[model samples]
Target: MRARDLLTPFPTVTPGTSVIDAARLLADHDLPGLIVVDDEGLPASILPGTQVLRLAVPRYCQDDPALARVVDEAHADALLSSLAGRAVRDVLPGRPRELPVTDPDATALEMAALMARTHSPLVAVVDERRLLGAVTLKVLLDGLLAQ
Candidate 1:
């Protein structure tokens, strides 16, 4: 099976978009995150919800005390209060690693191996360097269950 066979199609976001806007999209669509795409329509990274929460918190990284120092030791607590008030880009994890590509001709075992090696729940399906969609655990499992 290929990624297109099981991958769900979700909206894509561009780089430098406000984290607040991304969070709104997640809430409106009831999605986990948005796929950051480049101009040529390639997957760039993911902006997941939990990352947004982290950004909203007020903490001074021991090495980087800039935020803490700016807020002053007294006002730091007030500034670092809530995730709801913050932007997604501030707290999102580093981008997810890209998965290797394989043709639909590849065996199911080959797909499984790639997934395990990359530790990815999904892999992008490509043909001649074009992304068609994704193949995920749910899609693969559904195929097996049907058989």
Candidate 2:
């Protein structure tokens, strides 16, 4: 099957979206990540949920799993205070990795390989410069297992 066949509508955020807001969307939808769109609505980058969590948690807590457990939910919320006015772009480390983009006609296997190589949880299926949708890891796995 083609990548288009496995595509599903997914959440997207612009570069200027608040980091806290993005994190809330990720948590509410249990999304692995969000596609970051450019001014033309083309895929620009992928913001993995892990990156948001990295910003929420303290460095010491990240270093020690035990310390993370000690942080109560309220404290955890407090930890995100630093990200209050930060934009999604600010959370990205260094240069953003190239978005994993695929043609709608590409095979599911091809899409899977691209995602694997890029270490991305989703692939944006685009036709020319327009984004059609995304092929998520869960959808890709289901498609492969069904075959």
Candidate 3:
């Protein structure tokens, strides 16, 4: 199957997109990540879901996971508010990963190779410079393993 054949519409966020809004998009769509598009509508980066979680959790909790256990549910609920004033660009890791992207005509195997190499859960399917959607790992695996 071609990459486009496996395409599943995915969400996107801009550098200035609110982090809280981006988080809502991830949850609402149950996505593995979102494609970060530049002002010109070109694929610029991939924002994996885990990265959002990293932003929500306090650094102390990350440093010592046990510290998380002591935080009450109310506090846990408040954690999300931390992202209120932040934008996607502000929270992105200092060094972004290689963009996981594929051409519309690329073979499924080619998409798989790129996803694995980049350690990304989805690959953006672009045609020339246009954003065409994406092919998620789940869809690709299901197609490959089908009888």
Compare the candidates by TM-score and give the number of the best one: 3
Model 1 residue 98 CA deviation (Å) reads 4.6
Per-residue lDDT tens digits for candidate 2, residues 1-147, read 998799988888998999989988998988988888989998888867777788877789889989888878888768878789999888766655556889999998798888888888889888988889899899899999998
Winner by TM-score between candidate 2 and candidate 1: 2
Better of 1 and 3 by lDDT: 3
Tell me how many residue pairs clash in candidate 3.
0
| Candidate 2 regions with alpha-carbon error over 4 angstroms | 69-73
TM-score of 2: 0.88
Better of 2 and 3 by TM-score: 3
Q: Residue 83 deviation, candidate 3, in Å?
A: 0.5
In candidate 2, the residue pairs with backbone N, CA or C atoms under 3 Å apart (3 or more residues apart, or in different chains) clash, namely none
Best-matching candidate per lDDT: 3
lDDT of 3 by residue, 3-104 (tens): 878897777899999999999999998999989999988788887788888999999999999999999999998998999999998987665556788899
Positional deviation of 110 in candidate 2, in angstroms? 1.4
> What is the C-alpha local distance difference test score of each model?
0.59, 0.85, 0.89
| Residue pairs with clashing backbones, model 1 | 3-134, 3-135, 51-91, 58-80
Q: Tell me the lDDT of model 3 at 127.
A: 90
TM-score each candidate.
Answer: 0.54, 0.88, 0.93
Ranking by lDDT: 3, 2, 1
